[model samples]
Target: MYLVKIIKLALVSGAIFIGVHAFAQDDNNKAVVMGNFQLDGQYYLEDSAISAVVPEETMALSGFGNILYRKGKFTAGMRFETYLPAPVGYPAGASWSGTGIGYRFAQYSDDLFDITVGNFYEQFGNGMIMRTWEDRGLGVDYMLDGVRLKVRPSDWSEITAIYGKQRFNFDNGTQFVSDDLGQGIVRGINADFDLNSLLDSIVALPGQLSIGGSFVSKFQNNNSARYDFPENVGAGSARLKYNIGGFQFSGEYTWIGENPSAQNAQIVNIPDSLDPSVGLWATGKGVNLNGTYSTRGFGVSITASSLSNMAFQSQREAGAFDSWINYLPPTSVLQTYLLSQLYPYATQPNGEVAYRGDLFYNFKRNTTLGGRYGMKLELSYTQVNSPNIAELNDLGTSRNGAKIDLFDPGDEIYFSDFNAKLTKKFSKKFKGILFYQNIVYNNDVILGAYDYDNVPTKGTVYSDLFVFEGNVKINKKNNIRFEAQALFTNQHLQDWVAGLVEYTVSPHWFFTVIDQWNYGNGDGDDFHFPSVSWGYIKNSSRISVTYGRQRAGVFCVGGICRVVPASNGLSISITSSF
Candidate 1:
């Protein structure tokens, strides 16, 4: 393992030195130097409600930037990151406060092939089963640290392969378990090909056809343990797409191996008896399965995915960073408004099955009703279930005489929503949209599960929201947009009303103000949350400042979620490019 690390370092260092020295001598290299940087600094005003995490009236600064040089077939780049006084809400005991070259890599590409060393991002198909990427705002990044290759032998097909270890943050450190082993390794291969091209030479077929497949495997060394654990884990997926005239269809399916992590485990209900096999046995309450199955598409998708005792991660020993091996499909509808997201569904890492469908069409551009008005609609539904479990009991006067009990499996955890919207253009500068949304959410199953303090009670929340939005043109250099919404609901909180106004000055500046008020609460205490923000954009640089009172809620992307605390203060953000 040490030798492999040495070799990798030597290769990257040599490549960087050679690439830079060679490019310096080429007069017509045509290489362009470019990249961007961003800095975020915040000063918190004293607020007792939000001061538990950070001191009152304190300030913190954190920033990151990158530099890249691209010439004809070669490219090299590096990124620098710093956290002088790491911002609030960072993970407890996190020590990522320093300035260093966090990411460095070099790449070479041409008509036939492309290669990269040090760091890169890749995805297989829809990334339902395998994806390695980054989302900065969410603090999620899992870039591979090694070598990647891409090949194109023909015009109709391409292939890619990669081998590496996942990066956590700024440094490379080993995870120390009770029985220390070596680092883990991951490798994957994928290919995309056009079926029409192949059939054009062999047979006659109409329309366009495309298909792709990918396979990924991870290796981990296991030490002595009472239970059996597989050293090698593998997953694969396949996809197909067909388009002919006005009709189009696409589908994907993925299968994963049994790789249990922290997310999937069985819960034990212990009694007064000291016997190891006695007491009530309970399966983990959340999503738990044997392996994993996922199928999704644009036309119609019916997915029955079960994750038995499977906690997919790139490094079995590393902390949660860029280590997820499988993507957890979301089983709840995503709400767009700040108030509507009060009880958001966090993905159950243990198990779930979901089905979704979407349809869209356009009317003629010049008819009495269809000419100026464009009609659009959307509908989505999801369902969730718990894992199956078997109970065991053995503590008694006769040790050999033991009893086993199995509990009945639960029903689908949740179900929701149908939404629709219509838009019309009064003229080029004036446009309006009428929107309606209906959602039936199961609060007891999702939120109750997270906030265990509350007892589990079954109830459905139904909401009807009507919104009218439009944009107006004052002149070629100025425009303004307005929105007004009313929500009617009987469960949870009372009915609410909201509004927003935005003004933009062409070429560089814009400002927006929004407010939401719970007007029909029976308790007579109506809460109000409001904010105003201004942004300046030029080329690849942007700056934004916002001051407001924010309500707390769960923020999520994909299936990952984080709870954002309520804050009342001013925030500033700056981004620039060279």
Candidate 2:
């Protein structure tokens, strides 16, 4: 049955692409078709040691395909997706089952104007005010389903406008509905100017400079029973970028009108009379700044941001990454190693101040301290904290209402990390890397834990991690890589050690073996997580398989995160583009 469904989807998608050729009106402007496909399936098994839960169906699968057509200045595309009760850790579940068209769009573009109707993704200046995008790996697809228009007045200036509804979910009800996307309608407009280009046309200018501004608003019906909800909410942002030689600086400030919703709601002490006048209502604001300088083999960068009640969403009641109208940019490094990802950070939108800094230097080759093949060193530090806010004292129970200062960094630290990496090529065929990291994680805030009395149940956890990795080219056709990692901590799950070995055969196949050991648990109990995987790649297509015991942890991509449950499963993945 699964195989039949897969083949059926492929055929349907192919037919859709092939049928587009009939729309080619001119022989000289024939249509060009392109697309890509991916499938991930997993079979679950019961594992008592790790408390792995087996799905009722024992297996799950999800897949998607996008087909695009282009001819002259006209373009169109459609994406079909299916989730057969997605895997255990996937964001989709029974609610997203079955198959249907997830996205479809038609666009026309020329030198001065561009327009798109149906579904599209867009962003405005650092995405502080508006951003519609997708990260399939994270199951985050917030494409707007409506109309978008772009007008370029000149080479140095442009304006954009959009009216749409953010895609929320694929509800395969009796009618197979995917539209009427969210509870609210979103509308936005933006204008951008290139100062350097505009001035250079009249007179020469140094370096480059650009400025942009955006305004986004959402409207929803006021049908609340108890609280007097605001029917319309608006947000705006201004941003600028300047570059001179090896130095660059960029910044943005965003502000939003009162928007009371579940994600950022706070209780207020009001009259006992059942009146709809008082409820969770508050405005929001955000600020982001960055500066960088680089020259030769050295580079340095610093970034800082502050957010207060910035959980902007279309649906007032939506939660957990749903109906988001804006995104808080990430400020931390992306960790790829298995254990390093166990404690990944997720951006806090409620109220926080974050900072990140990076320094990189490359040592010259064939010098006294540079060695034979040169060396590269990278250092990074990131920290996040609660915003400095004055209390309103309206809650009575405690000071709940907040008066935030966007520039002040608070005393309560949420998370901090310092990491360094040194890489070198000792020989023509060998390369090695040494990495170290120290993290201070506030579990009470980041991981979230509270007792029945609303008291904190977890404290801060400090950990030190070390990793060493090496790659060796055995010959022109064979290569080997290995990694050894260790983590020491006194809190949470205690200490861990892990190792990985991978072998690659030229052009086609690869195999991997990995294991993580919880050898220093505070309870004196030991556990082992082992996994094996293999893959084959050819051209643009690849297939991989794995059988493994996965530890429960947060999986993150660019600071956005989702919980992945513990599991023992056999998984298969296939991807191809054409």
Candidate 3:
């Protein structure tokens, strides 16, 4: 029986870690147990395309360790992890090897009131709707396993409550029913206020204001009632923030319920028996979606900012990572390196909506066009859709219309980006930057049309990039930095060229070199990726080494993406802290 349920869950997690370390050593007041610890390990040096899809390439290791404790006001923690043969894109049914004690908690607070139980991580307000957090190299975790409460009843009110069960990967054993086995619950509550002290007693206002609201619910149990689902799945949110001084503004709105996702299913091909009369067609048994969305923000003064319709997720697989949610109110604009790689978009927990904005300005130190200078400009936009379906027909005649195509629904993923930059300082060993970028991509909804190794063309994709970055200072320990990029795509892989160089010898050591060239692909072997690295940082400990040629795309973290295969050599990393 699975080794007696793993030895009774390791004897109930070692008697709850020895009864919370013997009640913190019988409370003996000598308080001061701060905490800090870290360890990271990696080693790999064998490649047959990563050992023929990781059939075991001689060496692989993963580790995590944490132990925190604070005295007065009480606080406790635990985290320990190990993955003997876990690497090469991790998650392949996980559990390559295991070790327990993955986050245990206890907390208490003063100055008002607060409490927490087993595991906890929470977020409301601009979290768009809800959030639960944890991010382990993007493996992502939705930590929530019970009690939590908070209260503050004075200087502007505060309240919260939560109850739960969520944390899926890591051994995959507690889904707590519901697949029709009944018993599945999740609940939440929230409040925050200080609406500028009720709008300054109903009058004078120039800034400062806050308001919040939240309510979340989920309970599962269904006998598949001919498909009516929604055994309670609720959502509600409202928030507003305003400030005046360097400017700031915020907004939020959310609603959810009708849940029924699996991308809304729409598979049909039934006929093992049951035949009505050869003219019997009745497809569309899934997809009944609707989950409202709204997010807004505005800013000025220190430049400008604007945002709208931010999408958020608490589970339903919470985008896999990009970093633990709790809220991710920024819709687009993350862009970094490689033609702004597409990333963790996975939150469609049943529906979606999105929006984003940004702006910054600084220039007025030396004249002649601020030539001692600085300049920056940015723009972003995003859109997503697929909800609201119900259209079935066949026998009763409706012209063969059979809705519910949700899975991959009405396709339309969006993106738009613009950037401009210029910075210069000629003294202190020179410094420079000049950048330009323009991007628009849809690419059949961000790749995944089987990643087009089978060519068809035009699903919307455009790119333009130009960059020149530099830094040089030969004194005080030596330094050098440089980068150049140029990419202009025509469709898929039509143009790309990149370069980087780095050298730093400060408190420790550093060295790096990189190259990427795809130079218009008509299949002339235009793909080449190169890399080299060396690092050693003392004072807390750090180590790094690399030799490479890696390229295989798709490695999203947070919308959960994985599909990396293409390797070519030595790598090592070690980190330590105490």
In model 2, residue pairs whose N, Cα or C atoms come closer than 3 Å (at least 3 residues apart or on different chains), thus clashing, are none
TM-score of each: 0.77, 0.90, 0.28
Better of 1 and 3 by TM-score: 1
In model 3, the Cα lDDT at residue 85 comes to 53
True-vs-predicted CA distance for residue 569, candidate 2, Å = 0.8
**Candidate with best lDDT:** 2
- Candidate order by decreasing TM-score: 2, 1, 3
* Model 1 per-residue lDDT tens digits across residues 508-543: 999999887767755434356688999999988899
lDDT for each residue of candidate 2 in 1-578, tens digit (9 for 90 to 100): 99999999999988967665565656767878999999999999887766676888899888889899988788999988877866777664215667878889999999998999999999999888798888765577778888999999899999999998777766441121123323558999999999977898597778899999999999877554645667789999999999999999999999999987767754222212243333345799899999999999999999998888888888776665677889875577876776787666678777889999999999999977579989999999999997886766555433246677776778998889899999999998999999999988888777732221223338888889999999999999999999999998887777889999999998999999999987886433436888999999999999999999877777665335666667898999999999
**lDDT of each model, Cα atoms only?**
0.62, 0.81, 0.56
Tens-place lDDT digits, model 3, residues 1-578? 99999999999999977876776676663345443434344444544422323335445666666777776688888777665655665655324345566677888987788898988888877554568766565455667778888888766778889887655556413232234333435678989998777567678777687878888776655444233445665777776677665445555655555443222221111212122222222211111111222223222222111212122223322233321323533244455665445222333432334443444445554666556644333333444444344544465532332233333334454445566666666567878777777766554554421222433245766678888888899899989988888888776666778788989999899999987777576653536667898999998777888777665555664444455555556567666656
Evaluated at residue 539, the lDDT of candidate 2 is 94
CA displacement after TM-score superposition, residue 306 of candidate 3 (Å)? 35
Please tell me which model should have the higher lDDT, number 1 or number 2: 2
Error of 3 at 27 (Å): 15
